[model samples]
Target: MRKHKIAVVPGDGVGPEVIAAGLEVLQAVAAADGGFAVESESFDWGSDRYRRLGRMMPEDGVETLRGFDAIYFGAVGDPEIPDHITLWELRLAICQGLDQYANVRPTRLLPGMQGPLRPELGEQIDWVIVRENSEGEYAGVGGRVHAGLPLETGIDVAVFTREGVARICRFACELARSRPRKRLTVVTKSNAQRHGMVFWDAVCREVLADFPDLDVDFKLVDAMAARMVTHPGDIDTVVATNLHADVLSDLASALTGSLGNGATANINPNAGVPSMFEPIHGSAFDITGKGIANPVGAFWTGAMMLEHLGEDAAAERLMKAVERVTENGPRTPDMGGQAGSADVTKAVLAAL
Candidate 1:
């Protein structure tokens, strides 16, 4: 049997709760598949640990992750900790440290779920948002000088490089080529921010020239937002800067069903470092320990992890089981069903 090593990081709040449910589903799927085995090691590294030790993770955290075949990450944020501190120190740290530059988020309305959109329009929302993960607005390239003064200016530079943009564009194009649509929408803001975003736009066009078979279009960020709701079916594969895609994917999640059902994969396609799989839903502190946090996103993320590990049959099987549960099994509060996270986990396990 093929054996894979997995590093599990159940970060904070309901992260542990949903991750527990996801782990259960993962084990059951692995058992049912019989072609492979997953051995996991848990790393209790997050706000709770930060309270004990001043850092969210150890200094060598990224190095430790390098040894695993893949990483299954839970959410990483605490209301007690400043959002910037939590995000920069934990989640963004791992992503930038490991150079996991392709952040892929897939959104689709499940069979039995009700989206905020018109029911028929909801059915047409099947799109994948690929963010340029390692750079752009989240690049951490600015500074704040002058403390406790009226002139305390905090500047965050939106940094983009030709190489960075090209690689991500190429990555998105390759993904578009794989899908039946073979179409890509490059999100840009070249009208306002001339230097960096225009550079981004130019680099992407240069890269697209190599991918002659792709059907491509460039849409400004604002219009793209309206298009997502007004015409959700028009978008199939989208690539944008880190900031734009981050916001759009949230909107994407909302239009489909709930953030509780969103799944993300942070990948380093060219490197040997482990890629991270996570639910795009942040740590829901209000639902922490309530046993009602939706596990479908986590379960779906587990399926993504399996696919990254080359377990195609297991990944497809896991997603099928998820579809079965979401269609007719017990539901979670986020999904408008009264069932708790555990119940949903069991329903998926049973489907498996």
Candidate 2:
């Protein structure tokens, strides 16, 4: 049997709970398929680790993770630790270290699920958000100065380079070309942030030349938000900077149904190293142990991981099973059903 070594990091809060459900579903699918297998090594690396060792992970965490086929990451945040520390030390560290520059998030309304938007706007909210993951606003540049004084100031610099912009735009354009609509909406704030945003627009224009058949347009980030709500059907694939895509994808998730249903892939498109797949939703600390935290995101993320691992048939089967479960009943509280995480997972496994 074809075997894949997976590094599973079930981070803080409901992360472990949801990741457990995802793994169970993955194993079920693999057993049923019988053509391939997965061997996962679980790591206890998160807030509890931070509290005990004064770091989210060991100094050699990234290097150790480099040996895996792919990283199946759950959420990474804790009430006890500051958000910045948790994010930078673990999640960002992995993304940057691995050069997983393309953060792809696909959002669509599942069958029988209702978004906050009008019920009439059925499945038109389908869109793929291609986020420039490595650089941009989350580049970890700048710092604080003159602490705790009247002249105290903090600066978080957004680093954007021509190479970065061109590569991401090319990736987005190629994605758009692959889709049925062949439309790409480039989101930026050129009107306000002249330097970086203008440079971004230029790179997009340059990249669009290579994909002449792609129908492309620009939307200032503010106007793009309204367009997403007012005319989501018009959009098929969207590309944005790191910070903008992060915020917009959350809105896209809520528009589709719930943050619980969102799935993401931090990809190194060149495949030089393993990519990370995860749910876009943050660690819901309030419902950490409640067993109501949604596992659909985790399960969907697993399907994505399967696809990345070249198990397309298994990935499709897994996703179809998830859709079947969502279309039927016994959904988690996030989907307005009374069932808990395990119940929904059971339903998915049965559907599979």
Candidate 3:
């Protein structure tokens, strides 16, 4: 049997709760399949660890995680720690360290779920957001010179390179080609941001040449937002910068049904290193101990992890089970039901 080593980092708040539910589903699937095995190592790294060690993780955390086949990451935020510090310290550190450049978020309206959009829209709003993960606005390029003074000014430079832009656009195009529509929408603000944004448009155009059959178009970031809501069916694959895609994908998730159903994969398509899979809904602090935190996102993330690990049948089976449960009944409160995390997880396993 093929055994895959997985590093589990249940970050904070509802992270551990939802991750536990996901693992249960994963275990159930593996037991039923009998084709492969998953050996996971859980790491106590997050806000609590930061409070004790003055850092989110040990200095060698990245080195330790490098050996895993994939990283199954839960949400990473706490009330005590600053958001930027927590994000940069753990999540960003791992992504940059591993060179996982493409952040892929797939949004679709699951069965029996009512999205903010009209119920008639249904699954027509399906979209895959290809975010330029490694660089762009999130790059820690600038700093503050003067602190706590009227003259203090901070600069956060947006880094855009030809290689970065081209590779991401190519990835999006290939993804678009794989879909039925073969359509791609490139998001940029070139008219305003001359240097970085304009360069992004140029690189995307250069990359489009390689895929002659693709039906590609460009839109300003602001206009793209309206189009996503107004005409989601017109878009199949979307490519954008880090910050733009981050915000857009959240909007995409909300339109599908709930943020609790969104999952993301930080992939290094070349397979040179391990990729990271996570639920983008974040740690819902208000529902941390309420046992009402949704586990659909984490379950979907686990399916993505299995897919990345070359377990295609297992991944598809897990997702079909989730859809079956969602279509039937007994959903979490986020999906307008009275079920708790464990209840939904049990329903999914039973469906499996």
Candidate 4:
């Protein structure tokens, strides 16, 4: 049996609660199968810890995380802390330092999960949004030229490299091949930013030549958004630059269900380094301790982590159990049900 060590960072607010649910699911699946052993260690590195320790995580945090098989992360944000300080110190630090460059978010609606989308647009939405994690718009290369001055100026440069663009495009293509639909769409604004967008388009064209069997297409970000609203079924796999991907994935998540139920996986496939998994939603400080937060997103994220770690059996079982739970319709308030976080989590465990 393989024994995998998992580092659990039960971040701020409902992070702790949902992580508890995910851990419960892990233990339940392990107990039933007896095929693997998972040893987990908890870390206190979130907004609350930040408030007391004056740092999001320890100085040697990446070193500690490197020792584990994978890091099961919860959301990180606080009303009291500045957004930059909170995000940079915690989530972004792990992503950049660990080089988890493939932000793979599968946007699929759970059976009972409902959102504010038009009723008719509900049933026909399922797709994966693959974002180039490392470079491009999120590179953080540029900064403010002046602060607290009459004429304050700030600039953020989008950095795109051949390696970065090619890798994510390939990842998206591979994902599309696995799905029922074998179509891959590359999103960019080559009409505007000639250099950067053209470079992205060139890489997409180069990558597509390698995957000759797959159907390929490209669309501008603005027109793609309109198409997503009208004909989401036309899209099978979407690969885009960081900033464009950021907006489109959120839209994709909304189309499936509430933002609270969206899941994300940040991966570095070359090294043996494990991926980081979390929900798309931020810390809900307003409803933190009220027990009203949804745990579906974090639980499904655990399913994705299990799949990535080569625990295919466990991952499939957990996902089926979640689908069963969702199909039964014991949803939380965010999805239009009155159940609390623990209630929905317990229901999922029961189904498992």
Root-mean-square deviation of each candidate, in angstroms?
Answer: 0.8, 0.9, 0.9, 1.4
| Worst 10 contiguous positions by lDDT, candidate 1 | 267-276
Error of 4 at 4 (Å): 1.7
lDDT of 1 by residue, 240-282 (tens): 9999999999999998778999999999986578999999888
Comparing 1 and 4 by lDDT, which wins?
A: 1
Each model's TM-score, in the order given?
Answer: 0.99, 0.99, 0.98, 0.96
Q: Which parts of model 4 are misplaced by more than 4 Å?
A: 118-120
Please provide, for model 2 over 1-352, each residue's C-alpha lDDT reduced to its tens digit, 9 standing for 90 to 100: 9888899999988999999999999999999999999999999999899999898989998989888899999999988788999999999999998899999999999887999999777478879999999889999999999999999999999999999999999999998998999999999999999999999999889989999999989999999999988888888999999999999999999997789999999999765488999987789999989999999999999999999999999999999999999999788888989999989999999999
Candidate 2: regions farther than 4 A off: none
Kindly list the per-residue Cα lDDT of model 3 for residues 95-122, writing each as its tens digit. Answer: 9999899999999999989888877565
Q: Is candidate 2 or candidate 4 better by lDDT?
A: 2
Question: Residue pairs in steric clash, candidate 1?
Answer: none
Query: lDDT per prediction?
Result: 0.92, 0.92, 0.92, 0.86
Number of backbone-clashing residue pairs for each candidate, in the order shown: 0, 0, 0, 0
For model 2, give the 10-residue run with minimal summed lDDT: 117-126
TM value for model 1: 0.99
Error of 4 at 12 (Å): 1.3
TM-score of 4: 0.96
> Roughly what TM-score does model 3 have, to 2 decimal places?
0.98
